[model samples]
Structures are given as C-alpha cells and as structure tokens.
Target chain A: MVKASMSGAVSSMLNCRASSLVLVLVLAALGGCGGASVSVPGLFPVPLVDRIPLPMGLHLDESLTGYVHAEELEEQGEWEIDLGSAQTQMFQNLLSGMFDSVYPVANPAEPGGEVAGVLVPNISEVQFSTPLQTRSDYFEVWVRYRFQLYGRDGELLGEWPLTAYGKADEDNYGMQSREPALQAAAVAACRDAMAFFTVQFRTIPEVRQWLLTEAGGPSR
Target chain B: MIRWHQQALATGCLLNLMLAGGCVTSTVQQVRESATGMNETESVVVLSRKTRPSQEETEADFVNCISKSMRGGKQRVNVVGEQAFRDALFPWFEPRTAPVNASDLPELISQPELAERLASLGLRYLIWIEGDTDRTDSSGSLTCSVTATGAGCFGFLTWEMDSGYEAQVWDVRSGNLAGRVSSEAVGTSYMPAVVVPLPFIAPVRSSACSSLAQQLKSFVLNEG
Candidate 1:
C-alpha cells in the first residue's frame, strides 16, 4: 500500500511538471505572435494670454502641413507615438502671446490686413527615439524648426533655427511605462523650443528692428 | 507528440522566413479625377520639389531613377530630365522657396508667365517626390570596447530602417491635383558580430524609388 501511494504521487508530480512546461511554451508562442501599439495624445490648448496687440500673421510651412504618427515594434510588444496637433497649437499659443492679431495661413480670408510682417514657422525635423532603439534609460524626443519673418512685400526679413529636446527616465527596474515618458519628453521639447524662440525673437537684430519700426518707436 | 513537434517546427521556420525576408508596404492615395492618359506627343516632368542640403545626392538619384522608370514603362511617356525642366522654369520661379502646393494650384497657375512656360514645355503633368529614408529603431546587446590593437564589439545588434516617401502629381494644364502616392517600407537588419556588418535587411530607398516610379507610371498611363 505504501509503495503504491508513492508511485501515484510521483506520477502526479511528473504530470504537473509536464503540464506547466506545455503552458509556458504555449504562452511564449502566443507572445511572439501578438501585436502591441502605443499612441501620443493630441495637442491640448496652451494657456491663453492677453494679446500683445501687434499685427502679425502666422503661416505654417509646407512641411508642417500635416500631422504624422510613428510606430515601432519591440521584443516585448508594439509601440506607437502620436505626434498630435501639438505642433500647430504650440506655435499659435506662443505667437498669440507676442502679437495682438494672429492670422493662420490656413484661413485665406484672414491674412491680417495691414499687418507689419508675417511669421512663418517651418518644422524642419522631428525625431523620436525609444528606449529600446537608443538603448537608453529614457525616451527621447527632438524637434527642430526654422522661424522666419517675412515682410509684407514677400521679402525675407529674418530667420532663426531652433532645436529642442525632451527626455523621460525609466522607473525602477522595468516597472515604468513608455507612453507617459514619451509624452513628457515631447511636451518638454516643445516648451524648450518655444522658450528659445521667445528669447531669440526679442534679441535678434532684424526682429528687434522690425518690431521697433512697426511699433513706431523703440519704447514699446 | 511527434505531430505536435512537427507543427511547432513548421511555425518556427515560417516565422524565421518572414523575418529574414523583410516586407515592403506602400499606400497610394489619389483625388477622384478623370483618368487622363498620356500620349507620345506630351511629356511629364519628375522633379524633387525641395531637396535639402543633406539629401541632394539622394534626391538626384531618386529623380533620375523615376525618370528612367517612367520612360521604360509601357506608356512610352517622354520623361523629361531634371536639368531640362529646371532650365525651362528657373529665374521665373523657384520650387525650393515656393513649393507648389496642390491646394494652391489655381493661384499659382494663374500667373501668365508660369502658364506660358509650362505650355511651351508641352508638359502634361508635374510629379513632385519628397521625404526621406531613415533608421528608426534599434535593439539587442551590442557593446564595443576599445583595445590596444583595435576596437571591437561583442554580441548581436539589430536596427530597423523606415523609408517614407510621398509623390504628388499636378495636372499642369488644369492646375489640379491629378493624384498623390505615398510609400513606406520598414525592415530590421542584424549584425551578429562586430567585425562583420550586415548592410541592410531591406533596401528601403530602392524599394521606395521603384514602387513610387511604378505607381506614377500606372497613374499617368491609367494602367492601374
């Protein structure tokens, strides 16, 4: 009776081990075939500020005409990044703070009549690097732009090249999520770009001249 | 048990084959318009609307490939060289400064000089190809350490390349968007050792060029 009981227990243990092994294999197969995706959120409205009351027209260049969503795959799963309309909204918000009247090029009717000059913002490049791709601890985002000031006569007045970077670090030991980090990086990069533009726009000689001349005096 | 093992082996082989043979994915979007066929008498000009400083060489190669492919197609359309097209239109207009937007066609073609120049060239359509091919993602354990004799890397490294391109067609005579074609190709390349390098798992730029050219030919000839 004792021998029989021991034999039965050994057989049951072997069966359990075999079943667990099969289950793991099946799960591994499923994981290899499964697909995953990630997305970046759309642009939320930036804080509205009191208009500066200067006449300025804002035009997005041909390159900045549309939004793009980028995607990638990893050993773990699939990932997606939504570029959102944050680009357009960011510029609009920044320009609104500096100018009294802001006109979007999309609207043909609103060309900012009697405006001093037009500010054309061209998105030169947008690069997003995932942690898996860069082999880095953080997700990275970089945005490069060229801000050009054009006179009413269609002559180029001034141009400034601006670049911004954003990064989000991984949490403790693979516990972190990528989407939030990516979003934070992108937002930070945009904010940095805008801040750079704000400072450079005021200091650039050509821009200073244009603003001062348009305002009819240097004091304003 | 044998049958199950065989099934798993077959699945693994299939997966390996799929990974080894990278896929080419393309998308073509065109506005609803009357299919205007090309004839021997009329010609089409394929040009890069905006060639960045870094992409000049690639742009030139792309333009040449497209023109060559269009000429080789069954349509027998006269694909003009970029130089000839530039010579005909330069000084009067600059594509880099003012890209011809499909939406702003009417205003652009309304210019008398522009219309006359295009008409003189006997140009039926203008195809604008733009965008770039770049390395997007990379992974695996690849570490390089410098030794006294030389530098070497250990372990395996793999990276993904993405090629995204858009070709916009404009009906020169009507100043309307004839069509737009976009192609995207993605593939992963691997390097097992530091000494030996696997160039490209997928030929993205070539794939994009060939695919775009073929589609343009079909679009113009109304073959597809």
Candidate 2:
C-alpha cells in the first residue's frame, strides 16, 4: 500500500530532477511486501404461502417453516419469538457447542457397541422481553426459554418449561466489546437450556439404567 | 510563455481529474449491483442511491439496499457470523449482558422496528446486523505534558465496524415478527473464501454512492 504512496512521491521528484537511478532502486524496495454470494439451493419463485399452522403444537410443518416465523405465546401471556426454521439451525449450533463443552458425550458412542437412551429437547418458544421497557442503558437481556422433552423411543417424555437468563451491564470499551456479550448471551441461553436437559435426564430411571448397563457407568 | 504553459497544464490536469473521477466513481457505483446480478428492475435504480457525507455512507448503503428493494419480493441480506468474530478477534474481553454502552451504539436502527411493523402488515423476514457494525471514532484530544505526538490530532468523527449481524425472521402467518439474530465478522469484510464475494459492501460509502447505483443495474436484472 505504501508502495503507491512512495511511487507518487518519486515520480514527482524524477520529473523535476531529471536524474536519479539510485532513488529509483529504493522505490522498487517499497513495492516488495505490502500488500495487498449465496445461491440458495432448491430456491425458486413459488406461489406465496403464509401462516404455517402447527398441527400438534409440537412440530411445525416443514414447508411453511422455511422462513423465520414468529408466534406469540397466548398461554403464558407473553411474547415468545420462535425463529422456527432458524431455530433448527440454532439447535444444531448448540449441539456442536455442547459437544465442545463435554467433548466425549459429543462423540458418537463406539463402533458397534450397544446403544443407550437419548434425550432430545424440543424448544417450542423463546423470547427476550421486559416486564416493562426500561431506560437503564446497560447490556441486559431478559431471556425466557420453553422446551419439550423426548425419550429415545421417540415417545413424549414430558414437556415442561425451564428458564435461565443473564443480566450483564458494562460499557463496550478498550478490550471487551458489547457485541460479544449480546452474542454470548444468546448462545449461552441455548447452552444453558441444554444443560438443564442434561441435569434433568440424568435423574431419569431409564437413562440411569442405560448409562450404567451400556456405558458401564451409573449415578443415583 | 511560461505562464501560458502553466495555465495549459493546469487546465489539462483539471479535465483529467474529472474524467478519472467519473471512471472511479462509476466503478464504485457498480460495486453493489454486481452482487444482485440485476438491472432493469426499477428497484435497482432506486435502491442504488445515496446522500452526501461519507461518515454515514456505510449505514446508508444497507438502508438503501433494503428499503429500495423492500417493496417487491421479500429480501434478505447475509451478515457475517457473530461467534466467529468474537473468538478470532476480541479474545481478551467482550461485554457481557451486564455492561453494554448505549451511547456508542445507535439507540435503534429503526430497521427492525420498521421490519416488524411491516411483518404485521404482511412482509417476510426482515434482516439486519446487530449492534457494533457501525464504526466508532477512536481519536480525540487529551492535553498533557505528554509526548504530544499523535495527540490532539484526532479531529474526524469515525467508527470502525467490527462484527455482527442481526435479522428478524418474521412469521407472517402468526403475524409475529419475532425471530432476531445478530452476527459479527472477524475482520471488516466477510470471508469471501467461505462464501462468494458479496455483490458489494452494504451501506455504500457516500462518496461512492453514485457508483453503487450503477452496480445495482446488474443485480436488478438478475432478479428477473
């Protein structure tokens, strides 16, 4: 980048002085180092369709879930934002993170060993809201997460709600930046939600049995 | 004769400057349009536009792109990832939920609000980068018996855009404009290697606005 800068200077001097091979040599030294779309798949213009009605209130229809869909929770009398399709992506990212947190569990059990029970939590609703909007300028995210549980047999274990949120208020300055906190809060919310499942599933009888009998490990 | 020579030279230089400026500016304008691969769509001509002052140009670029094309078919702008940014760049410190300085960041982009409002009216997903996209001016005057060198010279108001993007994915069905995500980049521009080069940087620079308009020509046409 500076090469251009020096060149601009040298060129001007050369035209003025009429002679300087020596400086020209130094000029080349500058040029030396320095420096320097997504085609959505299977995408096309299709007839516009809106409002995907979830049949069982458990799983949303795939077709209508393509875009970010939102549904306010009338039950809790609160506004919950479900990215719908986007949540699937968020869930995948969370699983990858959990694997990183507890590395071994993330790994596929073993070659052909017996399989143990699995727990999959379906996050039905999530939201960042306020009891009432406040003007206290700080990085505070009031997050509420709602999820349903499924057992390995693909049977409905129990669908309950769990909540864990964070409140961090610090100015984004010199070293630490604000964006990271906002991002971490979101990811942490997802992770904590996973952790809650881990804690709960560990208490289940079938899960406990599977862990001890199959994986050679068990806890009361 | 010397005076005449100087005058002639000055006139030639002026003309060249304007001519070169036109070429450079037009090339800049073509930047955004190159991404969309469109031209002809009336949306292209309208959206690829800008107002004066370079400071807000980046913001203007995004606003123009989204607002101009907002009406027709649903639109989406891809922003860089958030975690990738924090991990790669700001390893030492990152603000937690407790301490976010509001003054540094714009109070509200009004984009999401506008997008949400539109969702209720029947629009699709409305996307935006989270806070920190806007650059922050870091230079200022601090008087002292100091080295004085590099001191008090920070005059220009500016901001360096770090990383992050947020988009409100709306469900027009339930009429809930809920889904929101913000992402950031490790460096200024997104990784072109991971993905194709962005048609152009969002929120075109003010000085380069006209050129951005020219680029939109191709993008609008491609949309067809």
Candidate 3:
C-alpha cells in the first residue's frame, strides 16, 4: 500500500507540471496578441496672458485638424493614436486667449482684408517611445510644430518650429496598462506645446516686429 | 478530545508565528526654520517635486495619501487638491517654470494677475515632497505549480524594502521657508511555502507616508 501511495504522488506531481505549463502558454498567447489604441483628450486650460489688441486669422489645414498616428512594432502588435480635433481645439483656445480676436480663414494663400495678419500652424513630426523600447518606467511622447506667418496680403513672412515633450510614469496608472498611460503622455505633450507657443510667440523676432507694426497701426 | 494544554500550546505557537512575520520599523524627524500657523480659511497643498529629471520623484499615490490623510481626523485642516491647484495656476507651477526656491516668490507674485489668483485660492502654504521607496535587498525564491484538482507551492522568499521622504513647507503668503519634515521606514517581507505559499507583507511605504502626513499636519498647525 505504501508503494502504491508513492506512485500516486509521483503521478500527481507530473500532472501539476503539465497543467502549469498549459496555463503559462495561454497567458503568454493573450499578452502577445494584445495591442492598444488611444484617443487623446482635447481638454486644455486657457492660459492667462495679456491679449494683443489686434485681430488675426488662423488657418488650420486638415492635417492639423484630423491627425492620427499608426505604427506596428516587431512582436509588439500594433498601436494607433487618434488626435482628431484636439490640436485644432487647443490652437483655437490659445489664439483666442492670446490675440484680441481670431477668425478662421478658408485659404491661407488669399487671407481677406479683415484681419491684420494670418497665422498658419502645421505638425512637422510626432514620435513616441514605450517603456519596453526605452527600458524605462515612463512612456514618452514628442511633437514638433511649425508656425507660419502671413501678412494680410497673403505674403509669407516667417516660419518657426517648436518641439514639445511629455512623459507619464507607469506606476501612476491603474493596472499599469499602456493605453491610459500613453493617452496621458500625449495630452501632456499637447499642453506643453500650447504653453511653449503662448510664452515664446511674442519673443520670436519676426512675430515681435509684426506685432509692433500691427498693434501700432495697420501699416504691415 | 484534545487536552487543554495542547490548545494553549497551539495558541502560543500561532502568536509567535504572527510576531515573527510582522516586522516593520519607522522614524520621523522635523526642523523648524520659522514659526507656522494656519487659520480656518487658510489652506495648504502637497506637491511632489518633478522638476529634476535625473532624480527619482516621490510617487503620486504618496502625495495623494498625504493630502487625503490630512483632510480628515480631529486636527484636519483645509487641503487643496494638487492637480486642481496646478491647473488653476497653469504655466506658472508647471515643471519647467516653477520656482525652485522661496526667494523667487517675490518675482513670481510680482504679476498682479498671479497675485490676484493666489488671493482667490486662499493658499497659505506649498509643501514640496521629494524621495522614493526602493527595494533595498532581496533573497530566496518561491516556486508554485498547479494541477487540474488544486495548486501547491514549495520554497521560501524574503525581500527588504526601504522608504524615505522629505517635505519642505513654503509659506506662499509670506514667501518664507516654514519648516521641513522627513520620514523613513524599513521592513522585510517573507513568503514561505509548504503545500501553499503564505505571504506576510510589511507596509514599508505606507508607514512612511502616514508618519510624514501626521508630522506635516501638526507642523502646519504649529502644534507639538
């Protein structure tokens, strides 16, 4: 009877090993197939700034209004980020707060005579890095923006590029998943872009000169 | 039936086992650079230092813990939410633009608009927390396996954790360094497995957060 019991215990141990292997295989399969798609929130705080006493026109092309980034990494499945209307709305709030008045222009080539000058904003590049890629505890995002200035007569005056960065710590989020952390980082990058532009807009030499002329009178 | 002495011996063994598993120690210290007090209308905010990129920042949950803890209890005072305060004073309190020292407050509040905003919030103090919890040491290992009928584990594991945090209270209204409080905690957690793994986790970080919050509350209240 003792020998029989020993044989039974050995069989049980083997069965346990097989079951554990199956469980691990199932979890690995699920984890390997899971990918994330995140839609960033458009909400931004209206900055407190002394508004310039000049009416301006803002031209937002479809690229800035409806932007989406999609990529696939080896063995990491696929990722998609839909930033639709977030950038457009952010710029709308920023410009309105910065200038006395801002009106949308249909075409930048022929901006009407109602505005002092026309401002055109474009997204030059967007890049992101995951914790797995950087071997860090944070997910980071970077956005590059270029602002073009046009006189009321539709002449390109100057173009300036600004780069903004944001990061979110993985430990701060629940479940420590990729979607929420990535979305938070993306929102932070947008906020950083807005803040940098608001602070540095008047500091640009060309924009400063244009502001002086436009505010002083409609000479430019 | 089991004898009375057997029952007593079993109870004693259980108590000893519990005592062996529960091992967490903590310490708190403070320095008063200036006197501090708060009225009923005045409030405070706890913010983690995020300006330094090379240093490990205090966890968000720890800040939240301090805020939440000080908001309740008998000695509880008014506490402003960190995110709301940052959002309301955007661009100014941001990581890139925030003032590093109390001396910068004169220039910071020089703007009439910012001063007015500060007045509106009745914000009296700004507490900046810095530090993090880390796994100091770890040893042993535990292995588990599962079968269709049940699961079992066999091994032993133990790990040591250490938490350290410091809070610098800045009186925004006066633009003076009010005081500083620091907390430290160390603990060892263990998991020993026979047929099933039994885990005994020591609350290292939680203990540090509690001690820091309590000291901060009293420090702001100017109480012993």
Candidate 4:
C-alpha cells in the first residue's frame, strides 16, 4: 500500500510541474507579442456637395504630412500609427471637392494671390482603446484635427477643431489579431472626420463669415 | 423485465438529450403609425442608429441580414445597399448629421443638391434599426487538461442569450413614419463535455433578424 501511494504522489507532482511550465511559456508568448505598426488607407470616396465658389490653397507642412503616433501601452507593448500620408491625401480629396479651385501653397504665412484663403491642418490628438482595456467587445479610435484658415494676405481667419470617433466589433473579426481591428477603427474614424467636416463646414461661424465675404462681399 | 418507472426515466433522459441541441424562441410585433406602400422603382435602405453615444448601435451584420432578406424571397422588394446610399447622399446621411426625426426631413432635403441626390436614388423607405444581442446569463464551468497520451475537456457549460431589435420604417418620399417593428428572441446554449466538448449554440440573433425581416417585408408590401 505504501509503495502504491508513493507512485501516485510522484505522478501528481510531475503533472503539476508540466502545467507550470506550460503556463510560463504562455506568459512569455503573450509578452513577446506586443508591437504593431499600422498604416491607414488614403483612398476615399468623393463626397456629394455643391462646391463653394472660392479658391483655396492647401498648405501641408512636413510634420502634418509625416505624422506618426507612437506609444508604449503597458502590457500592449509598443504601437506606431502612421497617419500623415493618409490624412494629407484625404484632405487633398476633400478640399478639392469642396472648393471650386484648390492649389498647393508653399507656405501658409504667404499664400499667393491666386487663392482666396489657405487651410493648414494638423493632427491634434490620437487615442485608441482595445477590448482588453475597455472590457468591451469593440476596439475604438478617436482623432482630433485642428484646421487654421489663413486669408489672402496671410492673416488668420479662423481655427476649427474637429473630432471623430470610430469603433470595430471584435466579434466581426473572429480572431485574436489586434492590428486589423485597430486599423479598421482608424479608417472608420477618418471617414467620420470627413463626413463631419463636409456637413458642418458651413455651420462654423468664422468659416461662414469667410464664405459670405468671399461670395457676396462685406455689404451684401 | 424493465419496470414502468425505469422505462419512464429512460424516455425522459432521451427526450432531454434531444432537447439539448440548438433551440431558440422569438416574438415579433409591429405598430403601424401611418399608411405604407411600395412600388417597383421605389426601394428601401437599412441604416443603424449611431447618433446616440450612450446607446449601443445595431450590429452591421443584422442590418445587412434584414436588407438581404428584403431583397430576396418571393415578394422580392427592392433594397438599396446602405453604404452606397450613404455615399450618394454623403454628409447629409452621416451619423452625426442625419435627420433625427421625420419632421427634420424637409429641412434636410431643402438643399437642392441633397434633394437631387435623393430623387436619383429612388429611395422610398429608410429603415432605421436599433438594438443588439448579448449574453444575458451564464453558468457552469469547463476545464481542459492535457496528458502525455491525449487532451480533453470535462464539465458541462451553458449560457443564455437575448436579442432585442427595433426597426423604424420611414416613408422618405412623404417624410412620414410608416411603422415600427420589434423583434425579441431568447435562447439557451449548451456545451456538455466528457472528453471532447460538444457545443450546441443557439442562433438567437439570427432568429431575431429573420423574424424582423419577414415582418418588415410584409408591412412594407401591404399598401392599406
């Protein structure tokens, strides 16, 4: 009886050891899986809108054109999101569609005589949340953009801050991969920004004033 | 010889085993607020309500399911793709900018550009869907362990899922609330394991979608 009990105890100890080893390996694997580099798409569908009859100059600085958000998120490790090229491309498409004429200005401080006003846009903030963090079934992203409008003589006409939010259901992806879900969220945010900007542009008081002055002059 | 109670017990066990598979129950109701009708040229678009930040919006797949159902079947109602219609209207139909109520439609379409786009799409009805499916309750436990010879799971696990969705149909041409349809479904799923776990997943959301689509099709077609 003593011999049999000894053999059983040895087997149980061996099983416990094996389980511990497996748990350690899983933890190591999860720790090693922490970095993701994402690039959002630039292509967007043209919006349907009556073009404003004003000539606009798009001034994209190096920082806005090559913007990158890099952060270390505790257990999530490192994340690098490149939104510069995509934002630049989307703005080009959106502005061209909105204005009767859109041209690139070398500098916002000295917009040429050909354009009525110059629009300088920059990313104000980028934030994201994963299912692990929110304890929800969705991955979400939020982007804020600040647009500074400069008049013909390089005087600041107005500055508008636009915010956009997007989310992707984790159940839709059906996998453990986080990159695709985050990318989708980011793309959705960009689309939201485009939609909001297009609809609410004329509603902004300063922009409306600029439009009225450009179209009907100070008296009218 | 088998006793009467023993035979009854065996039969009961067999019946329970048969009932352990996927089973779901659904109820659908409709409220007609105004007259409704549809023509050959006129079509419908299914959109999820995303204006409210606090409320959970309807799932995209559920909207597509309703759209697809409307497009198919014997009645064969014309259905416009959501994304395409949204893109055609652009900013006007966006989440934040979309008209909140039927009363706001006139102001929205007052824009010549938006009016023209709406006319071109031949959109007669806009179905705005809201709600989601969630696991309401869960119990039991499942544990899996691996040995040198093999791996297996042991235990019985079960969960309850509930789906509730409401679709509001608007007659865009008239800018009137034609009707509203609601679908509610409840189901319990089971996973019983001795060695390998056997999953019997109840299609709660699918049931809700199917019932809602059926009711919506009938409601739209019946021109009273």
Candidate 5:
C-alpha cells in the first residue's frame, strides 16, 4: 500500500508540471503576436542659451512645406509627421536664444510688425526605420531640412540644407517597447538638427552679410 | 494535425481579405449654383492663388494636375495652359489681386479693361484651387536597428493623413460664381512586421487629386 501511494503522488506531480509548462508556452506565443507603434514624443521647452545677439528683430515663418515618405503607411504620409510644428518650436527656442526679440509671423509677405530678417524652415525629407528592418535591435530616424533666409525687404539672402539622424538601442538583456525607442529617436533627431542650425547659421556668408548690413555696416 | 492546419489557413485568408479591403477611404463634397452660364466652347483656366513665394512650384503642380485630369475626363472641354492665361492678363491683373471667395467676383470683373482682356482670351470658367494636404495623427511603435550587414525594423507603426482642398469655379462671362468643390480625404496607413516589414496603404495625394478632379469634371459637365 505504501509503494502504491508514493507512485500515485509522483504521477500527480508530473501532471502538474506539464500543465504549468503548457500554460507558459501559450502565454509566450500570445505575447509574441502583440503589435507595437512609434510616434514623436512631447518636447519640453528649451531655455534660452546665452549667444551673440543678432542686431535686427528675427521673424520665424509659420508656414512650412516638405514631404514625408512612408509609402507603406499612407500617401502623403509626411503631412502627418507634424515636423512643421516641431521645427517651429525648436526654431523659436533657437532664435530667442540668438536674438533679443523674436516674432512668429503667419504671413511672411505681410508680417504684423517690422523684422530685420525672415527665416523660412522646411523639412525636405524624413526616413524612419523600425527594429524589425534593421535587425540590430535599434530604432533609427533621419531628417533633412532646407532653411531659406530672406532679408526684411523680401530679398532672398541664401539657403542652407541641414541633416540629422537619431538611433535607439537596448544595452541590457531586457527589451523595452519599440514605440518609446522610436519616439526617443525622433526627439533626438529634432534636437540635433536644431543644434546644428544654431551653430552653423552664423557661418553662412549671406547671413553674416545681412546681419552686418542691417546693423548699419558698409552698405553693399 | 489537419485541424491545426485548417485554423492557420483560415487566419491567413482573413488577414489577406482585411488588408486588401480596408486600406483607404475618401469623400468629396460639391455645390453648384443654378445659373446657366458655363460655355463648353470657351476654355477653362486652372489657376493657383498666390500666397507666398515658396508656394509657386506647388501651385504650378496643382494647376498642371487638375488641367490634365480635366482633359482626360469623358466630357472633354478646352483646358488652357497657365502661362498663356497669365500672359493674357499680366499687366492688368495679378494672382494676388484675384478674388478669393465667390462673393467678390462681381466687384472684381466690374472694371472695363480687366473684363475686356479676360473676354478676349475666351475665358469662360476659372478654377482656383487652394489649401494643402497634411498628416494629422500618428501612433504605434517601431524599433529599427542597424547591423554590419543591413538594418531591420520590428514592430507595427501606423499614421493618418488628411488632404483638404477647396476648388472654386468662376464664370467669367457673367462675372458670377458657378460652383464650389471641396474635397477632404483621410486615410490611415499601417506598417506591421514580425520579422520582415510589410507596408500596405495607398497614397493620400493621388487619392485626393483623382477624387477632386472627378468631382470638378462632374460639376463642370453637369453630370450626375
């Protein structure tokens, strides 16, 4: 009787273990089938950094034009990117840092107030890649923009093209959601692009000439 | 084993059907006035209202697409090139000074010289297209990583696009508004990938252009 009872207990233990294993396998399979998404994250306002003040009041044009390419996603998908509004915020921050007074202009042709120069920013291209495509376990985003600077008189000063790229990857064994990673990548790319513009804008000869001339230097 | 295979096949067929059917959705609205003054013999000129210097190329493209689509319509009508129309009215009228809303048509064409020049060109109807298409909402997550060999993206990403356009038709002879056509197209796109990326959504611009063009044709030709 003792031998038979012991054998019955062992059999019960084996069945219980098999049942638990099957449950875990089913849950894991379901988890693998779950879907993920990516988007631009909210940005905190950038504090004004100390920089050489531009002589004339600067105007940031609100109208932005560009194309977003995610054909598999939708036609004219770029319009959904909202890069214009993103750039507007970043450029406002940058211009406020460089100029004592910065104005947001709805119509560059008919600005409400007088401004020394108008800066038109446009996102030319955006390329987004998911971790599934890269297989590197990272999310990547790249953005390109064209900046056209016009003098107060509506004369085109010059145009500059800027580019930025961002990537997100996991450093540990545990993986986070891909959406957060993509959002982080997009935010980083925008910040990097704005930073590049703030630093390199002064280097453009036309920009320098326009600033100097507006400050009452030798008229060309 | 046979039952499991059947379940898998059923799931695959359902997914294929869903993908093929629910990719894009579009809607068009049009309003035509009852005044009978559109002459098929006279040419219709498509014009883009000048807003900013940067919009020049975009306006040109819009004009070209609308004119081409109108020409391809079953009820054929004379479509004039933008350059010829501009050349005919250069010194007297500018796109900036053109009437935006239908209400301003009477005051605009009241001037003798402007009316004469427009009449000489045999311009019967002017189609003014304005507004832009933009992306509205985006959600989902995508993770892409680069390796020495290549890059891969895993996860699903989806976004919504909206194309909003307003096309106003002006009858030049009567100096009256003939009709107004507005088209709004909204579509959601999805990118899903477990191991490989799958992109399945139609473009919004083409959909907007075609739908608007078709509506414009119906309005001009008075077709149901």
Candidate 6:
C-alpha cells in the first residue's frame, strides 16, 4: 500500500513536468536534441507523535492496587499495581507503570487545613495534534481539581492547579493492563491539586481552627 | 510425638480462604433544606408548604432523593410537598442527569416555573436575602445582612463565594445585571455539629433551579 501511494505521487509529478516540457521540447526534439533529467516529487507526510512527557510532583493513586513490584514504593494508600474491572486489564497495567511518582499530602487534622504538596504526574489536558494510523490508541481527559486547604471558618491559605498527561499501550489493551493507566491518569490529575494544598494547608485560619477546636482530629 | 493411626477425621468449613482488607464505608442520607430566596416571590412560595418551617419560614418534604443512600422505590419520590406528590395514592417523583430545557419543554424544570407555582398559591414576590452573619449568633437571634452588586444582576457565571452560591439580579428585558436585588445561598451542612466528617448533614435543597432563582433575586433585590 505504501509503495503504491509513493508511485502515485511520482507519476503525478511527472505528468506536470511533461506538459510544461512538451511546448518547449517539441521543436527541439524535431532537431533531435536530448531531454532534461527527471525530478523527484515531495510527498505529503502524516504528522506523528510518539510519546507524551509526564508532569512533575504527582503521586499516582494506587490505594486499591493489589501488587507493587518495587518495595520502596510500598506505602499506605500507595500500590504499584491494582486489579481493574474486567475486559481491559493489560492496557491498564501499561498506563499505570508509566506513572511512577509521589504525591505531597498534608495531614487533614492539622491545626490548619491540609495543603496540596509535590507529586509526580502522568497526564495533561493540553493536547497535541493526533497521530494518524499507528497501532497506538489515544483518549483525551480534561481535569479540574482545586488545590488548597480551608478552615472551618472558610479561610483560604495556600492553593495550586494540578494537571497531567496520560496514555495506554497498544499491545496490552485488556482490562487488567489498562487498570494501571487509568490509575496513573487519576494520580497525575491529583498531583498538582495536592501541591496546591501543601502550601495552603499551613496558614488557612479556618483549617487551623477546625483542627485545633475540633475533637478526635489531630489525634485520629 | 507420632500418635500413629489416631489421625482424627476432621472436617473443615470452607471459609473464603483469603483475608479481607481494612475498609472505610460511608452512608448517605436524604434531607430537605429550608429554602430562602432573594426574589420577593420565593419566600411566599416556601411559606405555602404544609411542612414549611412555621417559625423560621422553611420548606419541608423537599428531600434529597437523588442521594446515594436512596434505595428501590425510594428513588421514585420527588417529595416537593405538592398535593399530588403528597397524596398517598399519587406520589409524584422525578429523576435527572442534566438541567431541563425550560424554554422548549413545558415539562422542563426551572425556578420561574416554581415561582409560577408559588404565584398560583398567591405569593407574588417572596425574596430571601443572603449574607454572612457579621456578628456571632447571640441571644438566640440571627442577625446578618446580604449584598448583591453588579449591573442590575444581569450575568450569573458563579457567586464567587468560597463555598455556597450568591445570586445577582438582572433585568430579563434589558439582559443586564441590575445590581438592584440579590440573595445568598446558605450551605450549613458542613457546619461543625460534632466535628468529624459529619456525613449525615445534607445540602439545603434538592432543587438547584429553585435555589438558583433565589440566588439571582437575593443578589439583585435584597443584598444591601
């Protein structure tokens, strides 16, 4: 198919040159002179995007995951792998593996409200032009999550905007594989949101009052 | 230690041979709000309900039926205190996903329709003003004031309030925020009752349309 398209381009280019030369060369050919060299055509190529870069400071949410390959990543509410609903596991796993990062979290019971902190990320809303006819598949996700900690009295302290980019692999498109990717996407979304809260959690008066005055909070 | 042929014939109860992980479960409950709007019309409508808060002028039976806690036939009940919905034999109910197209569909739900219903019940302009209590609640009396500022309350993008909504009034004929009247949306669920998550508390109203109208009228007509 590729060869056929290439040849089609070459022939069209030749047809154009032939018509132009016919007027100039007819009388020259009548005098038995040789003709000019053949030229190659510049074909239109499709745009291709190979990979999307991961954002910074977004910790993937693997709280429901069943397994984690790397022990260093073994933390409460953190998992390397998780079981996804049936019909798309492999694809999930591929996406999840891509999101190897951490999320900054503040204690919700602190004197002030918690803040969103640093987290590694895996997804983004800003998209590039789609690539045509490769084995890879793509889906777009637009996320809007707030970052910052507020108090009982509604005082605002710190805030940040979280964003991410996400993709799943072509080979393992099953539910299990895809579960990783889905989680990676969610984690990437939360990273920026978490970062914002990290700063906001400290000084928000409402948060402080809620933490200090409220019972079973700082202890819990 | 070898007891020989004395191996007892034992039977095992096949318990699901896996340990269940720790969990956090949440339960949702449905409740109604005492709706107050800045529109002179909203107050009169709320006052007409049978279960309406007599002392504080609050509406009742406006349950949050859409909450996750609702089960089976419970989801079918609208509970808006209408006579048809109230009748034991004819309990009316509604479900939703998106805002109803009030302009095209006569069945579409909107605040104007609610206002019309209130108007039918003889209350023309029951407006409820919204604002924070500048002074702390003291001596069992609630003292506060609401403010609505803009061009005749023409546009409603968002209240710009931290948690709840505030309405700004607009002239429907001229299409501008009149800045003349307005109301405040009071969300008291997240209030500190016993600390903790306070999961039992629900939003003040299930009808966002009715509340949105209140916001507009409150901000435009009532806010100082």
* Fraction of native Cα contacts reproduced by each candidate: 0.00, 0.00, 0.10, 0.19, 0.00, 0.00
Measured as a fraction from 0 to 1, the native contacts recovered by model 1 come to 0.00
Q: Which 10 successive residues of model 4 chain B have the least lDDT summed? A: B142-151
Tens-digit lDDT track of model 1 for B1-224:
99999999977954674477465565555543656677777889887753222222234566787889888855567887876675455322232233557667666557565577677778898888777666677655543333356444444545666777777788876777888887777766554433322222455667887787888888887876
| Number of colliding residue pairs in each model | 4, 56, 0, 0, 31, 92
State the weakest 10-residue window (summed lDDT) of model 3 chain A: A1-10
Q: Give the per-residue lDDT digits (tens) of candidate 5, residues B1-224.
A: 99999999978964874475245677888888855335666778888764323222233455677888888856776788876665455322333344666667777567554577667767788888876655576666644443466445555555666777788888776777888898777776665544445554646756778888888877876775
Indicate the residue-level lDDT of B115 in model 3: 86
Q: Is candidate 4 or candidate 6 better by lDDT?
A: 4
Model 2 chain A: weakest 10-residue lDDT segment is A35-44
Q: Give lDDT: candidate 6, residue A194.
A: 30
Per-residue CA lDDT of model 4 for A115-213, tens digit only, reads 999999888999988777887767788899999999889999999899998787766553344777788778878888998888777887888788878
lDDT by residue for model 6 (B12-101), tens: 211111111111122222111222223323222111211111122122222112111111131121112222221211101111111122
Docking class of predicted structure 6: incorrect
The candidate scoring highest on DockQ is 4
Model 4 TM? 0.86
Please give the ranking of all candidate structures by TM-score, highest first, separated by commas: 3, 4, 5, 1, 2, 6
What is the per-residue lDDT of model 3 for residues A1-220, given as tens digits with 9 covering 90 to 100? 0011111111111212333533443343356565578988778877766678888899998998888888887777798877656877888888887788999998877998889888899888888888778877677888899999998889888999998877887777844368898898788788788878877888888887787777863221
N/CA/C clash count, model 2: 56
Candidate 3 residue B150 Cα shift, in angstroms, is 3.9
Off by over 4 Å in 5: A1-220, B1-22, B37-40, B52-63, B91-95, B102-117, B194-196
Q: What CAPRI grade goes to candidate 1?
A: incorrect
Q: TM-scores of the models, in the given order?
A: 0.43, 0.26, 0.86, 0.86, 0.44, 0.16
Q: Which of candidates 3 and 5 reaches a greater DockQ?
A: 3
Model 4 lDDT at residue B5: 87
